[model samples]
Target: MASTIRVRATSSGETTEVQVLIQHPMDSGFVKDAKGETIPPHFIRELTFEYDGKNVFIADWGAAVSKDPYVKFSFKGGKKGDDLKISWIDNKGETDTTTAKIQ
Candidate 1:
């Protein structure tokens, strides 16, 4: 299956900039469909980024987050060609993970 995560990491000698985009419904349980039924809450509960076995960034999200969320952050001490691991778990227990190389 295709990964639902898309990420990019770039190193600038001293820091690495990371950007991520995730595909998700992110229903807040307040909106209604055409039939006027409330949408159930479904959102990413946690997101994490790791480099060199150390976590550099983490996000605790809720249903208030918009769909297909985009995040950007920078961290110190990443080298070119090194790996950055990204993962997320949703409220439904669904998960996806991917690794991106610092460029």
Candidate 2:
């Protein structure tokens, strides 16, 4: 779907702070279009964040989530040069995956 995702990570002592932005339509199906037709539901259902091949965070989303959702999280034991992978699956069966290195 060519979705755009941005990730940022930083380490401080034993904790690493991570932030991510995902671009999506996130239609709730309850919404109406210009023709007053109900829009089909489309939203990210599952999101996972992995640190150096280990799960650091996970999210189960709903239609109520806004478009271009932004997420923030912090985890212990993340160091510089570690890999942070972010992946999501949408209700439409589309998926997006990205990775970032902690700075």
Candidate 3:
């Protein structure tokens, strides 16, 4: 199954606040099993957000991030009906994308 992503945006005056929820198993390679085997670290490393084809935000994360990570961010210049596209890449080379429209 693929990761689940949700986006929400609220506009007040001339600014838009966006919140994103991404469901993923951010595995950190620091745990050992009963057999004493090392676990591999796998997590989302980068996220990019664009508003109507213009770069709006970018985030770089590490293993310290939690599983099923959720991020809340806001930007200006977005208006009602504008499209917000978000894309992310994990340490394991997996990629996912989602979109939301300003309202």
Clashes (backbone N, CA, C under 3 Å), per candidate, total 0, 0, 1
How many clashing pairs does model 3 include? 1
Q: List the residue pairs that clash in candidate 1.
A: none
lDDT of every model, 2 decimals = 0.94, 0.89, 0.86
Model 3: per-residue lDDT, tens digit, 49-68?
Answer: 99877888998999889998
Residue by residue across 1-103, what tens digits does model 1's lDDT show?
8899999898999999999999999999999999999988999999999999999999999998999999999998899999999999999999999999999
Better of 1 and 3 by TM-score: 1
TM-score of 1: 0.97
lDDT of 2 by residue, 20-99 (tens): 88998889989999999999999999999988778889999999999889889899988899788889999989898988
Q: Which ten residues in a row have the lowest lDDT in candidate 1?
A: 1-10
**Best-performing candidate as measured by TM-score:** 1
Residue 38 accuracy (lDDT) in model 1: 92
Which candidate model has the greater lDDT, 1 or 2?
Answer: 1
Candidate 3 accuracy as TM-score: 0.88
Q: Which ten residues in a row have the lowest lDDT in candidate 3?
A: 1-10
lDDT at 87, model 1: 96
